[model samples]
Target chain A: MTTAVLFDNVSRHFGVVRAVDRVNLDIAEGEFFAMLGPSGSGKTTCLRLMAGFEQPTGGHIEIFGETAEGVPPYRRSVNTVFQDYALFPHLSTLDNVAYGLMVKGAGREERRKAAEDALAMVKLPGYGTRRPGQLSGGQRQRVALARALVNKPKVLLLDEPLGALDLKLREQMQEELKSLQKSLGITFVFVTHDQGEALSMADRIAVFNEGRIQQLGRPEEVYNQPKTRFVADFVGSSNVLSTKLCQRLGVKAAFASLRPEAIALAAPSNGALSLAGTIAGQSFLGATNRVVVDVDGARIAVASPAAHAVPAIGSPVTISFAARDLHPMEDA
Target chain B: MRSEKSNRAPLSLKIAAAAGLAFMHLPILLIFLYAFTTEEKSYQFPPPGLTTQWFGVAWDRPDVWAALALSVKVASIATATALVLGTLCAAAISQTRFFGRETISLLVILPIALPGIITGIALRSAFSMADIPFSFWTIVLGHATFCIVVVYNNAVARFRRISGSLIEASMDLGADGFQTFRYVILPNIGTALLAGGMLAFALSFDEVIVTTFTAGQQSTLPIWMLEELIRPRQRPVTNVVAMIVVVVTFLPILGAYYLTRDGDQIAGASK
Candidate 1:
């Protein structure tokens, strides 16, 4: 497989603050790659660098193995679906999609045909004459997709494309986007702050923090085996046990991550490590109950099925987990 | 009962509002009233008679036609100049960051913010120092100073409202800078530019104080109206021209109001 986008020690500094630090990454062609981080964590900045909207203060970038640092956005073979949709309000939906073709000097009739086909691909057929303002939030997103996909860029950069939608629509669009990317056979580099979105959509996830990638791996590896404290805490909220806490739990690793769902409150298992802790609080999560327990002054959370009875607050309980579920990570 | 009470203003407040409006507009309406009056020379609350004869007389006067022609020409040229210069200044101020950007924006709008007499005096002194003749072009140059401010204000507000992503999205879709401007920026700011141009045209059409200083010998419509008021030739004819001027200026102002009222609907504006 060829490398679609390569970031070789890319660094973008805004005065004293390094927005994107010396970050190295290789995104394989036709892969659904996600750069996931919180606000100001530089995930968005990295996407901007890829889109050619921002230049790195120091580094080299390649798109499809061609040098891409100084090339303006119009010259690059990449298109972006901006978070705000960015459909032209003045133009009809058809015209907004056809804008790229029109600017490239395509014949009017030919561009119209292509724009219509692109709209149809996004399941927005016969929406040509309608303006963006007339469409719903979901429809506007489809139009934005059609506008970008019409160009058939070598790499498509999606900047939180479904960030504006409600939960139901966001999930529906997430599935649609995954299938669409597969059918198109195009590499997608998606940037989002929501880890669930990154986990569900991306083939490979790069967890970013403080302007650097903390971990780069598949969703399962990143979730099941986080390499750093930041990744463990940030992705799926794994409990990062310090060296002292690990000792209390009979774990030899200096630092380890234990998932909330992996811990169970039960009448102690014979072969599992068990700890006595009082239930400090419990929150209702729809499918599960999150119980925060204080065990030897270390606050650990356990997710139990909501159908299961939750012990009253201040009630002592034993939380147990097997050795296989405890994963080790670096302190940082 | 509560809904009805909330919907209607008190009678005293309604009368006060009506009084304020009449105080401002009644005199202008009287000008429209007297334009068709038969009284030839003097003010009368209720006219001695009514006739359409003064409009014909105003139409026949060569000086009236000359002043009207000069006024139209100056306003058109001034509005056109303001549209170009004002749009360029607005684009620079709103689109990019540089040293003294806010200061430059303030200076561009300073001409209109100052009193008309101060601007007029400054222009006259500058023209004299430069040895430039006071003519039609001088009057246009004077009008353009304030006209550019009107265009700049409207264009800048709309420019700030336009999302920068629209421009970036345009470029990412294979549009060069010029193409991005044509496809994205221009269309988003189109209504604002039109409204700004209309307001500039209206302001320049009936301008008087600055024209008084710059027009050494030339008399625009407003200057001619002032001359006619002081040295009365036919009072009703002056009123006829005044009535026509009010209508001419009011139409564009009304058009501008309606055009920008729905401006919040512009895409990229909300975000």
Candidate 2:
């Protein structure tokens, strides 16, 4: 496969702080990729780097087959849907979408038709006369999407595009974005801090921590097999098994990740590994109840279905899981 | 708890409010009243008589017309000069960062902060030192020093309120520098520039002390009115000119107020 964007040991420093430090990454053409991390993890900085908004202090960047460094954003074959929506408040929706074409010296009539078509593509047909201030939050996001998409950039950069929307709208837009990417076959680079968004949308995920990529793989691989302790904790709140705890359980001494859902609170009949502990606390998640068991001094969480019975707090309990379910992880 | 009684103004406050209004407006009402008085000479309140003849005399006077023409021309050119220079200074200061940016901004706004007489004296000396003859252009030059400050104050406030992302978005959509400014920046700050230009024009139209220094032989409308007051010709005629000057300046200030009235309602960056 061809590389769409490449970062070769890219580094960006602001004073003494390294916002993006020595990062190496590649995205395939037409791939749906995600950069996921918490705030100050350099995820947003990386996105800005790709958009040509920030210059790296070291290393090189390439977009498609062309060198990207020192290239102004207007010259690059990429467009961004900004986090703030950034629609020109003074212009009508049609003019805002047509702005790209107008700047390119297209005929007025042709640009108007193209802008209208783009608006319709984002399911906002006939919204040409309304100002951005007149539209609702979700509608404004769709307009922002249309304004970027109208340019037909080779790559689309989305910086938390759904962040401002309410929950139902965010979920709806996620599904819509996935289908849009599929139909258009354009490379989409999405940056976000929400694990669920990254998991539900991106074909491949890169989990960032302190300006470094802790793990990079498909969603299934990243979730089922986290390479580092940070990835397991960040991706899905998996219980980290300390090397000391592994030795106590009569297993090889190594750091391992155990998902709470994988651990069942029931007596094992087929010689499966089991840990004895007291039920320290219980939280009622909508679909599953999370029970935190105090095994020795380590707090191990177990998620059981809502229909299952939960023991009272402070009661003794046994949590069971197969030997194959405990995946080893690095101490990082 | 707030009550209907609390919402109503106290009687004492109502009397004070009326007194303040009378203090401010009664003089202007006096000017309007005398503009129509039939008497050509000095003070007669509860005017001895009233007639429309002074309006005719004020209209026919050639000196009055010359001064009016000069005032309009100077104010127009000064305002245009301010719009260009003040807006550029504001953009340079607000949109980018460099050494001494704040110091430079302070200097641009200093002309209006100083007392008008100080500014007038400074300009007179500077022009005489340069050996530039006192003329219409000299008066315009003096007027621009302060007119530019008015525009800069308004333009800078509006520029700071605008989001930087709008410019970035324009570039991301393939707009060049000039195109980005035209399509994005200009539209967002358009009303502010218009408002600033109007205020600058109004200020220059009725300016007195600065014009006195720069206008060597000629008289502008306000300078002419000053001369008319000291060495009296027709006191009522001066009042007629005063009424016209008030209307000319009031229209623009009123327009500016309406244009920028909904400042808090300006759309914000998406939350």
Q: Candidate 1 lDDT, tens digit per residue, A1-332?
A: 99999999999999899999999999999999999999999999999999999999998999999998999999999999999998888889999999999999999999999999999999999999998878999999999999999999889999999999999999999999999999999999999989999999999999999899999999999999999989999999998777987887777789999999999998668888777889999999999999999988889999999999999999999998888889988765
Please list the C-alpha lDDT of all candidates, in the order they appear. Answer: 0.92, 0.91
Scored by lDDT, the top model is: 1
Give stretches of model 1 more than 4 Å off. A247-253, A264-289, A304-324, B2-18, B37-41, B44-53, B262-271
Give one digit per residue, the lDDT tens place, for model 2 in B58-108.
999999999999999999999999999999999999989999999999999
On residues A255-299, what C-alpha lDDT tens digit does candidate 2 reach at each position? 888899999999875968898999999999999999999998999
Per-prediction DockQ, in order? 0.49, 0.50
Worst 10 residues of 1 chain B by lDDT: B262-271
Clashing residue pairs in candidate 2, if any? Answer: none
